[model samples]
Structures are given as structure tokens and as C-alpha cells.
Target: MADSIAELIFIPAPGVGHIISTIEIAKLLVTRDHQLSITVLVINPPPTFGSGSAITTYIQSLANTTMDRISFIELPQDKTRQDSKAPMAAFTDFINSHCKHVRKIVADKMSQPDSGRVAGFVVDMFCTGMIDVANEFNVPTFVFFTSNAAFLGFKLYIQTLSDNKNQDVVELSNSDSTISVPSFVKPVPTKVFPTICQSQEGLEFVLGSARKLREAKAIIVNTFLELETHAIDSLSKESTIPMVYPVGPILNLEAGAGKASSDDDIIAWLDTQPPSSVVFLCFGSMGSFDEDQVKEIANGLERSGHRFLWSLRRPPSDQTSRAPSDYEDPETVLPEGFLERTAGIGKVTGWVPQVAVLAHVAVGGFVSHCGWNSLLESLWFGVPSAAWPIYAEQQINAFEMVVELGLAVEIKLDYKKDFFNPKADKVTAEEIESGVRRLMEDNKVRTEVKEMREKSRAAVLEGGSSYASVGRLILDVKRNIL
Candidate 1:
């Protein structure tokens, strides 16, 4: 019989960012070798909010080439109604309980005569339930963290959040400045620490996940070690095994494989503009802004004077809209007078071909929401950023990218008093102008940030850290599993 075809399964928590990253990983697994017949298993979440269903459609369309090699399974939705309070915990519980279903699916797949034996599994760190499924199959399971290495390291070591040594919340949040992590990371502000990584529940999840890391045969991060060598080194030293591999800036590499959907218009448009004259802005689907913040952003961009591309979506009901009337509303929306006033200088659209835009020579900097996908895209394109993180663990990511790595700068929001809330504070046109100007034109600032762009590009090239790690991961799978 022909050598058993290697079957690899991957499960990402439902989101475009996670789904897209997983798809790239799957593609790489096959492109690296012809012998592997890969199967990608996705767990579909409810369609009400942005879910994997949309991504499922997108991936299925790409399956014309893979045919029977790639397969998918949808999870049961949690329709049982409950109060919206503690939504985070509720959602986490729902996912945790879904492992039995995942296991059943795997068992059935293994029973087939022509079925490929499991070569390995790629489990999203958040979907720890997949660990049980991996254990049942007795395959080498690799945890795939779809975040920057610094962020992943912090998440893996989140137990530090429970320090009763400091009762002050302010002190705890800012501990990075005072507390030392030894030889690796330079101290940063606690104010930028992710709230999730700062809380008891969040800490428990992260630290517990670290323990699970000990059981896994490998841990793969979608980051290049050169970009986050200190944090990756720190994590490697602390872990039970040093099997951590940084095979990322993964999306760009996938793009290079010629598997990405073609969007030539993005390139055509960029050719018309002068070099480093455009600012591309977008937030992942999970991003949310109140009415006040939405309007503030619009006014800010309008005043920034740079040629711009803004991807605007319907802001949550609480957010204000000062969107101009000329732009479409609700869907395919843009503000009124948005395109006219900045006719030669701006293009406002609801969704954009982000990778293509960033790759354009005209694009100089980014005004980003700090989504990991966007972060990776920026690094890939060697672009600096104006970071405005909203919700989730983005604050932590922003700090690492900006304060720690110096690849981006923060757009600080000001309030009248000592007590401040992002929901209440407004970012005016003036603040926007200042931040944008600094990112695009400040000589000293621009020079330093430009160096980061060069470093980012070098990190993913042929002999680069990410390239070597991906090679090592593939070889390890071949030797240990196949």
C-alpha cells in the first residue's frame, strides 16, 4: 500500500481572524509536501454574530482543488436562553462543553477503511477542549496561538494576575513597570496590560493552558522569533518542553504560496498614488465602537490631511455617527462629503482587500484597531501604525507592538478628570491630526519606526526566523507522526 496519507485536523474558535489564520496553516501543510492529504476540521459557531459559517463558505469554495482531502464539521449552537450578564464566562462554558461532540466526530472519521490516520492536530489555544480529542486519538497535538509572541507569552503566564501582594488595581495593572521579568522583557506600563490577563478568571485560564502545554508534543505560534525573541525565549525557558516554534507572519507566507484570492484592483489603485502617501485603516469584525468614538474617529481622519482609506462598519447602537451623508449608510457605508472633500486624498469604503492595500508602495502607515491579523499585515508590509485598541485583549497587544516593539505609536484619548472611561471620552479631530502627523512626518519618529519595518521584513525571509521554524515544524511532524 502507498504510504499512509497524513491527516491533520485544526479547530479555531469562530472568527475571521482565527479562521483565516487556520486556513493559511492548512495550506502551508500541504504546499510544503505533496505526500500529505490534509483535512481541516472547523467548529461552526452561531451565525447571529460574526461566526465561522461565513468563513466556512469561503473555505469550501477553495476546496475545489483539495476535493476529498479537506473536510469540515459544525458544532451544535447553544440556543438555551439566559441573561446576557457574564457573557464571556457563558460563552467559554459553551465551548468547553462541546469537546464530546468533537471527539465523536474524530472517532467516526478514524473508523473508515480509506481514512487517513491522524498525523497531528492543530488546536487553538482558546479551544482547550480539543486537547481531550487529541488525547483520545493519541496523536501529536500542536497548540496554534493566533497572536503575537509577546501577547501569547503573557497569556501563558497570566497567573501573575492573582498577586495579592498588591491590593491596588492601579498597581496591579501597571506592575510591568515595577516588577521585573528577568533578563528578557524590558518593563512596560501596567496601564496597557490586557484586562483579561489582569483578572482572576483570565489568569486561571492562561496558567491552566500553560499546564496543558506540557502535555502537548508541540506549541506553534503564528509569530517570528526575531520579532519577539525576548518573549519567546522567556516562554521557552519557563515551559516544561522547548518545542515552541514561531512560524509566522504566517498569513503573508500563505499569500506568497499563490493560494490567496486575487484582487488586482488594490494594486492598480495604489499605482496612481505617490510613494508613502496613503494611510490604510480597518478593524476586524469583532471590533466595536460607541457613537461618540465613531464620530470622533471620522472627524480625526478628516483633519489628518493624509490620503486615506477607511473601512467603516455600522457602529454599535451606543456609538454616535457624524458620518457625512454622501457615503452609504448601514451597509457599504461611508460618511457624507467624505469622498468629495478629500477627493484626491481619500477613499472610504466599508470593506477592503487589506493585504493588497498594505502591500502597495503608496501605503505608508496604518490607523489600526490592533487586531492580530491587522498587526501581522502591518509588519509584513513594513508599515508603521497609529494604534487605537478597543476591547478584548487588544490593549495588551497594542502595548507590546507600540511600547515594547516600537513598531507603532499609540493615539491616547484624553478626559477632563482623573476618572476616565473609553466610552465617555471623545477623540477629537485635533488629536487625530497630531497622531497621524507624528506617524507619517515626524523625522526622528519616522526614522525609528522605519527601522522596525525593515526588521519585520527580514524576519520572514528565506533564512529568517519564521522560515526556519516552519521548516522545523514540518520535519518534526514527518519524523514523529508519519
Candidate 2:
């Protein structure tokens, strides 16, 4: 008998982090025995430049055999006279408006001779409009949440807030102290909620899309139940959709499969270092700080007197958010004469194969932006971290790592935001010095984090709940949904 074919459609939000998660899902499906096919549909900002657009190039570079199973579809870009200045809302509107285009693409693909039999749809959680397309095709669609189930449950609570009743989120977040969300599965700090949701319009947008998200056939969160059982259970009970699969630490598994790094020179440098002596610092694709904060971080690392590896990036010319204007030189982000001073102890690079660097023996601690991907990567390698969340749901993710899970400590920066012009003030040298010392000098804290690392590793292994759950998701999709 001929093998049954399964067609999976992917529609990721236009961001490097989102694309990375969507691609990982597609790749995982392929690794299973299913005869899988993927269609990546893009709707906003043209997906033509930056790390967001670079995903296409990376996909093309995948093995030619893999290329045969995946397809790309592009829609007409909307250049309407809209307020593109506000990125989050503008981007959300673009995705919602692309529903018609998305539906059209799915229809055309289904009609093609080589399209094979449609089975199930795997849509990014953010692309809630694609649910209608799946319904039209009479197939089950699962929402692949790119973050932890805790975040999703928190989002669900925020979605239920009526615009008329709750004009802004300030009431919810007035206290920096932890606020108990009435229906949420876990206790979350109001500060971790998205700042944009503080406004009425932003609240409406989030609530509207969230309702659409709840319409999926099933939900797949990229985190293990062992890591978030209570949150996952709460979400499953509340949602009408029954299936909630917690299959994660996915990056760790992928990284493990990667060949050992061939950077002999770098490895040699690390080998000479003492145990638990180096701090590894990396921000995700979108994480960037102003020049002042960058200098504070550099100075802090320098004063800590520890071996370090810091990955840095230069801001683009047209950038407004998260880009620093003062640092014109490529190396200006670093402290003055600091590179020479820490020559024997510090390594600065624009970017490195992050997973590989984290896996190195010499690396002991991580100072990170708390992006879910980076968080998982750090935990997988048994490295404790200093959490520094910059944007999006990072603060929320950081909360889980530090306060809830007891995996990492939060690094606070002192800055002021003017109502007229909101740019972060530079981080002071003292703030940097104290934060680094807390991580490197505290033995009791490091030991506790080491225990958490062991738990994280066990959560992803065979017979572990996460591994078993992923197997069930694949099998269920193939047998029932497909």
C-alpha cells in the first residue's frame, strides 16, 4: 500500500523568533515517519530583509531533499495609509487582514495535483486567522504556541478583560509586586504583562485575536509538562479545545543532534579556563539596549573579573525602537580600552553558533534576554543564568525562570522613561558591577541553579513526560486528525 501523505501549512508572524519556532515544528514533523509537506505563507513587511527575511535563505539552504517537501507562498503586500509607526499593533493588523490571502493560498495548494491528500494543519498561535482556512478545508488545525503554556494561559486571562470595563492594564499592573490573575493557572507579576496592552486599543486587539486562537483544533505549547504542569492543566480545562500538548525543550534536542563545533581555536581557549569561571552573554535576534546600557553591561562584566563571552549586534540606520544612536562605531558598544584590559578573559563577537557555545565545558553562567528559545537552550546545557528580559514576552518568560521556577535571577537596570520621549537611560557602572557579582560570587545561589539544570535535562529525555507527549502528538495527528 502507498504511504498516506500529510500536508502541513505554516503561517508564522513576521519575526525571527516566530520563524525559528515554526521551522522547528516543520522539521520535527519530518523527523517522524509521516510523509510530510509544508507551506510557509508570509503576509506582512514583505519578509525581505533583517533576520525575519533571512529565514527564507536559511530554508533554501536546507538539504535539497528536504526542499522537495516544503513550499513557499507569497501574498500581495498592503501599503495602505495606516499607522505603521507602532510596530506591534500595526503588525497584528496586517496578520488579521491577510486572512483572505491566506485562505486563497490554501485553496490553490489543495487544488494542485502534487498537493496530495490534506491531513492536518499546524498554524502558529499568533496567526489565528488561519483557523478559518483549516475549517474551510475540513481538517483539524493545531495552534503551535512558541512559548510556555504559562504565558498562553496568562494571555487567555488578559483576553477576557472587556475593553469598556478595563480601559487600561495599569490597574492590573499598578503594583510591581506579584498579582494573582483570577482565572490564570499560575501566579504572574503584572509587570510581566505586555506594556502595549496598557491602552484600550491594544487591549482590544489582543483580546480579539486571543478569542480566535482559542478556536484551534488543539494547542501545542513548546514546553514540557514537567516544567509547567499546573499551567497546562489550567489551560486545558478552560479551553473548549481538548488537546494541549506540552512538547518542548525542543531546541535542546535539536542542538544535541548538531555535530560538535569545529572551532578548535575557540574550544582551546575555553579549555584553559577554570571550572565555573566564565559567563556567557547573548541577546536574542530582537534584544538590543541603548549605548548607555551596553556600556554599563560591558563595564560590569569587566569589573566582575571573570572570563566572559559576549555576543553583540549593531543597530540598523532606520531603526527607532531598541536601537542606540550614540554608538556609531562597530566596537563602540564595548567599554573604552576595555577589550584590551580583559584581553585574556573576555571574548566579544557579533554572533556565534549560540547553542554550540552554551554547550562548551568552560561556560558556567549565562546572562540572557529570556527569550523562550534562549532560556530552553541554557537549561538544556545545564547552565544557570542571570535573566535580563528586554522586549515582548521576555519579562514574563524571565519571571517564570527566576521567581516561579527558581532557575535564574533577575538583573534590574535603573532608567527613566519620559512621557514625551521614551528611551532607556544608560545603566550605571554600579548596577553592572553588583549584578555580575551576585551571579559569580554567590555559591549557594549557583548550587540551587545547578539543581534546576538537572531537572531541566531530565524533563526532555526519553520516557520523560515531554518526550512521550511529543510522540503522542505526532501519532494522534497522523491517526485521527490526518
Candidate 3:
């Protein structure tokens, strides 16, 4: 049986967040079916980013352990400078250029005897261009959407509407007008729409990908049915979209390998604090604030008077750079005497073992950028949050967490129009203090998160919604081979 196994090829977009989640999904697939093999085609990061090496190291470590069932092939470095002024345009162009390379790899793998039959292709949502390549090979293709279902529902709805018209219908004005999406009961504020929907180019890029998504055999989201039942139900009603699978909360279970720093000191600090007394603030890999914002955050922590463990990083030179930084002196960026005043009550570091810190008994609350991965981690650990979204789809995630899911306290719902622009109303120290206090002191929010936490764990266990979804996906792939 093993000798005649089928292989699945995965192509992930070029980012730490996308790459890590895609790798975890592949691991889950291989674990579920022993007769399955996976080959991940990794795209090279642009030369400017430094954290690409970390992703490479993480993938290599996984390959070393699962040598027989898993392997990787990195796309050649793209030396041609990305000419698109917008980030989405640049990423879309990059993925479009790799269809030929992926087609060749799929062809070569199918021809080799020991390589097994090429059963299908699993691509990251950003790499939907590869759907064309999969169609050429006459193999089933699945899209792994790394975010929640509400966002996916919104995308599918917008795509359906856009297909009917030749021009962009979404108004990009700065008003507080609301738009009704099919998934949510409440109308979404136009300002809270994804950054990609704010501009003509970004909208076109998203619409193009959404169109390609319709061609996939299935769409897999990194969320559970219990978490986003409304959104999942809404997407399921769409006849044009492919089958949807809620097979996740697929997290990086391993520690120490790809972490930016050792968590020994952070853990030691948490050990000294009382149970559920400290708040942990960590933005995602790309999350950082300007010096002004940092000073306000420092003041807010002091005013909140709660024990805190803040994983701080110097803001990047440019907004587009998502690279994690080397350790630096906090005094240079923080206000004078800020560290001295918060010494006993807080510990600030460049990076910490996020999972370990969140799992600590002392962690009562979280101040997060509301990246989907960070949000899931906080929920998985039963920690309530002060949602402070930074970039990408974070604002939408924050909105869903606070408004739709009832999981978190809102700090700023729509902070910015896009990454290139600053927030219209800067978040002040007073708002931060209020938000932190609400997350830490509110008993109802704490209890709700704890309940959600249990649900999250059960969803991934045997016979649970996420667990069954994974099984169904495996069976679906095997059925295709027959």
C-alpha cells in the first residue's frame, strides 16, 4: 500500500505567517493518512527581508524528521525587482510568474516511479495562480485559506458581485457607510473592510484571486465550525464556490526552532507573577509601532498598573518590511524612566515564546495585533484580549473577535485605512489603559474565552469538528485518485 501511495504538492505564498500555517496543514495531512506523501514548493522571499532564513530552517527541521513522507523544493531567487507600487500587486505578480515552475515540478514528480502518483495540489490562498497549473495536470487542487471563515465569506461574496460588473463596485470613500455581507448579521462598516478592498489595484488583485478560488476543488480554512458557524454556513450557501472545509486551528506545536529569541528570561519573569495577573502583549512578526505610538503604549501600561510582559520590537524603517529584528536596548526606543517605573510590574523583551507565555498561569490577558495566528493562540490558551490590530486583515480579525465572536475587547476597531497611512485618530494612553483594564478585570469576557478555549481544543480532538474535517479532506483526496 505504501509503495503505491499518492503525493500532494503544496505551494505557499512567501511570508513567515503563510509558510508556517501551510506547513502545519501538510503535517496534518501526512499524519492523517500514512499512504500520503507531500512535496512543498517554497517561494524565495524578496532580498530585503531577513526572516526568510528562519522559515527555511523550520522547514528543514520538519523535513529531517519526516524524510519519507515529506520534502521541499524552493523556487529560484527572483532577482527581477518587483515593479508594482502596491504590495498586493507585487505579490500577485510574483506568484503568477511561478506557474511554469510548479507545472514542471508536478510533471517530473508524476513521471518518477518512487515519487508516487501526483494526487493533487494544495496551494495557499495567495498562490491561487497555481490553480491553472493544477488544471493542466488534471489533478484536484485545494486552497488553504490561512485566516478565518468570515473573511473568506466576504471575499466570495464580493467576487460574486464583482463578476457581474465590469468595474469595481466597492466604494473606497472615507465615510462610515456600512455594507451588508452575506455572512454576518450586522452590517460591516466600510472602513473596516480589508486593506485590499480600499484601493482599485488591491481590489482587482483580491477579486482575481477570488475568481481563481472558484476553480479549486475545495477551500480549507484554518478555523473550526464551532468558532465561525455563521460565516461557514454563509459560504456553504454559495453555489459558485467550491466545497469548504473548516479543518483547523492548525498551529505550530513545536517550540525553540523558529523562535526569534530564547524564552528563558520571559518564563522566569512569568514564574514570579501571581496566577492570571499579567497581561502579555505581542504583535505578529511584522507588527511594530512608531516611536510616538511606543511612548503612548508605555504610558498606558504604567497607568493600567497591571503586571505586563510586552514583547516589543523597533518599528521597521519602512511599513512593508516584516523582518524580525535582532535584540536591541529598550532604553533607546522607550521613554526615559519608563523601564524603571514598570520594573517590578512588567518585563519587556524583543521576542518571547508566544505559546509558552500564553500558556502560563500568570497570563490573565493579552494585548494583541489580532493577527489570526495570534488570536487563535490567545483563544486556545483561554486568555482574553485587548484587540490592537496593525496591518493586513488584522482589523477585520479584530472586528470579528470583538463584534462577531464575542471573544475579545476592542481597543481600536478600524485604526488605519491601509498600511501606508497612519490611523485617523491615534490611539491614546487613556484608551489603552481602559482597554487593558477591561480585558483583565472583566469576569464575563474571561469566562467566555475560557469556554471558547475548551471548544477549540475539542474541535481538534478525535470525533470533533476540525478533526472530522481533516479526515473528510483526506478521504476526498483519495476519492479523486480512484
Candidate 4:
């Protein structure tokens, strides 16, 4: 088995971010060990979510890349109707339904003489249900945790909450009381707990999934040790926890570095700006704002008197609509003459090459939704953030950035988007102006990020923490030594 090629099958949740990040890890393992081969099993989301165009495109880009050890296969859509469950539960149930297909694929891989030794399975945290399929094969499993270590510890800590303790969490969310997690340095406001896990069933689902992590041989987290020293330390100290490997920030740096894409017009504009002069405002792919909210942002940016690049998309008609479309005429949404007023100083575009933009010399600060991926990307480029988090676990991420990490200026840590009424808890222009100014003026944060950028780059090198962790992971998978 050691003489034959070792194959690693990666099962990522159907989200684009999850898929791409998982591929980055596969690319790393293959590059480090010439004996490794990777097969990424792609499962498209159920039909209710609009077009799967982005997901398809991202995978195609990988297939077209120069890497030969990595391969991608799209699984047949499950199409199993799980509407009887809650939204989050339904989505997870959808992932669970694909286990039979996963089992078949692994069986087929093992049967082929030239397919190499089945190293083990690498499943996304949300797809822990697939652990059963791995146990059936008597094979080891690893989880590619896409979030930060603090969030991971928070989940594990909450798993201790059962019966009366669980109800107290519900009450904490309903009220404004704060709670303590061993992972975080200070008390965490209950409002910032993951919005999905607020309900009793949601908490059970999150805890239930995270609890399965212990069954794995190890977990490959997309973070570096220096960034989350306390949380990572706590996780490592636990003897019962799965072997935790911090082998990141695993980004496709070459693809993002100095490479011009179809979004060259945006890049060309950045070329004209002075070094570290522009503030970038981008919500994630699902990010959009109401006209009133848009005007507020416009009012804020115009008042800040700073060069800026904003990626603004049209708000979806309702929450069920998965994709947000770009407006044909952005002027219709912005305040009249706002563009003309900031003509030389600002550019508003639909979609952006996020990493390429952050890599630009002229870009100074990021106004972001604080998605874990976005946070790591901005940090890699040595750019500070004015956090404007929306939905998901972004609120928790924002809190960590501002209060714990000191790498960001907070705009609104708890601004979740309202699909029905967009004006609900709208952040005012005053807040945006102050946050942008603070993001740029904070010498302390900027210096810390610049230092972190050097440390981040080093973490993946031969002797660095991330490099060591990856080596440990490879040995464990190759030898089943854990």
C-alpha cells in the first residue's frame, strides 16, 4: 500500500465557498506528497435554489488548471424533498441522502487495481453524516473545517448544553445576556451566537453534527495557529478531541497574485489610485441591500472622502431566492448623482475578483461581511477591515475580529439582512463613515495585519506551523497511524 499511490476522496458541502476551500486543501496535499491523488466529489444543491452556475464554473476552473493529481466528479442530484423539516435541517438532510452514492464511489475506487490505496475520506463539517459511510468501510475520516478555531470550540462547548442548559441558551438569545465560552477570551453576547442554532432544533442539529467530529481520525481546519492561539491551544489540550491540524490559510495565492481576469476594468481603475488609498466594500456572493440601505452606504462613502471600490448587487425578492442579481442600472438604486459626486474617487461594480483586488497596492481597507474566507483573504493581503457582517456565523466572526483579534473596525456586528423588510436595523451613514475612517487611521491594526501577513506566508513553508500540521496530516492518512 505504501508503494502504491494514496488516494484521498473529499466530500464538501454544496456551497461554492466550501467546495473551493476543500479543493485548495486537496491541491496542497497532492503537491506536498508526489504519492497522493485526490478525487473531489461534487454534489449540486437541490433545484429549489436558482442556477448552480457559480458552483459549476468554480469546479471547471479547477479541472482546467495545471494540477493533474486532482479530479472532480459531479454526483447525481438527490432531489429528495425534505421540506417537512426546518430550512437548516432540510439542507443537512439533503447532504445525508447522498451517503449511498458516496459509499458506491469509494467501493468503486477501492476495487480498481490502479486507483491506488484508499488513504481515507475527508468530509466537510456539515457533512458529518457521511462518517457512517466511512465507518462501514472501516476507514478513517477527517473533517475539513471551513470556519475558524474559535467557532469550532464554541460548537464543542455548546454540545455540553443539554436539557435545562439548552433552554437557557434559548433564553439568552431572546434576552441580551452574554455567556462565556472557554475558547473566547471574553464574554460573548448571546445575540452573536450563530443565528441558525438559536432554536432548540437548530441547536440540536449543530451540536449533533459537531459531536460527530470526535469520531474522525483528525480535523483539518482552515486556519493558522498564530491567529487563534488560545482557541487552538484549548482544542489541542483536550485528549478526547480528534487530532486537530491547523494547515492554513490555504489559499490559491498564485492564481490571485498579479493575475488579471475578465474584471480587468476594475483592476485598471485600481492602477490609477495611490498605494493603500482605496477602501473596498464587498458583501459576499449572497450580499445585497435595499435602496434605503444602499443610499445610506452611499451617503457614508461620499462623506468619508476616501477612494473606494464597492461591489453592490440587487437584493433578492425574498430569502428563498438563492442568488442576487446585478442591477442593469445601478443609478436606479443609488442616490441621484452619488456616482458623479464620487466620480474620480470611487468605482462601483457588480461582481469582483476579491483576492486580486485585495492584492492590489492601492487597496488599503476592506468593508466586509467577515465571512471566514474573506477574513483570511484580507489578512493574507495585509489589509484591515471595517466589519459589516450579515447573516450566517458572520456576527461571531465580526465580534472576534474587533474585540478578540483587533484586526478590524466594527461597522455592525449584528446586522442580519431582513428579506421582507430591508430597512430593519439599517446601519446609518454616520456608522459607515466612522468605521471607514477608523479602518484607515488605526495604525495599530494596520501594523498587526502587515506582521500577520508575513507570519501567514511563513506558516505554510517548510518549518512553519501550518507546514508542520500538513506533514502530520499526511503521515496520519498515509499510515493510518493516528
Q: Candidate 2, which segments miss by more than 4 Å at Cα?
A: 1-3, 42-85, 163-170, 174-177, 182-187, 239-242, 252-268, 320-331, 413-422, 443-461, 479-482
lDDT per residue for candidate 1 within 276-373, as digits (tens), equals 98888776654445455666666777788787777665543321221112224532333566556777777656555677778788999888878787
lDDT against the true structure, each candidate = 0.65, 0.68, 0.82, 0.83
lDDT of 4 at 50: 54
Which lDDT tens digits does candidate 4 get at residues 10-62?
99987777877888899889989988898888777655555544555555455
Residue-wise C-alpha lDDT for candidate 3, range 171-239, written one tens digit per residue: 642456877888786787777777667667778887898888889999999999988999989888879
lDDT of candidate 2?
0.68
Residue pair clashes in candidate 3 = none
Best by lDDT: 4
Query: Tens-digit lDDT track for model 2 on 1-482?
Result: 14767777777765556666777767766765556667767544433233333344444433233345676666566666345545546666667678878778778877898666667677777777778778888888888889888778767777655443553464664446555653344567666676555555556567876787778777888887766767777776774544788888667344323323534555677788887788988877645566677788888888788789876765544533333222235376677798789889987765456777778888888888788888888877777888777666677787777777777776752122222125655656776667667767767667776666676667657778777887887777766433
Query: Of models 1 and 4, which has the larger TM-score?
Result: 4
Residue pairs whose backbone atoms clash in candidate 4? none
Q: Model 1, residue 441: what's the lDDT?
A: 76
Comparison by TM-score, 2 against 3, better one: 3
* Model 4 misplacement above 4 A: 56-66, 163-167, 254-262, 318-320, 418-424
Measured with C-alpha atoms, the lDDT of residue 428 in candidate 1 is: 70
Q: State the displacement of the C-alpha of residue 333, model 2, in Å, after optimal TM-score superposition.
A: 3.9
Give the RMSD in angstroms, all C-alphas superposed, for model 3: 2.3
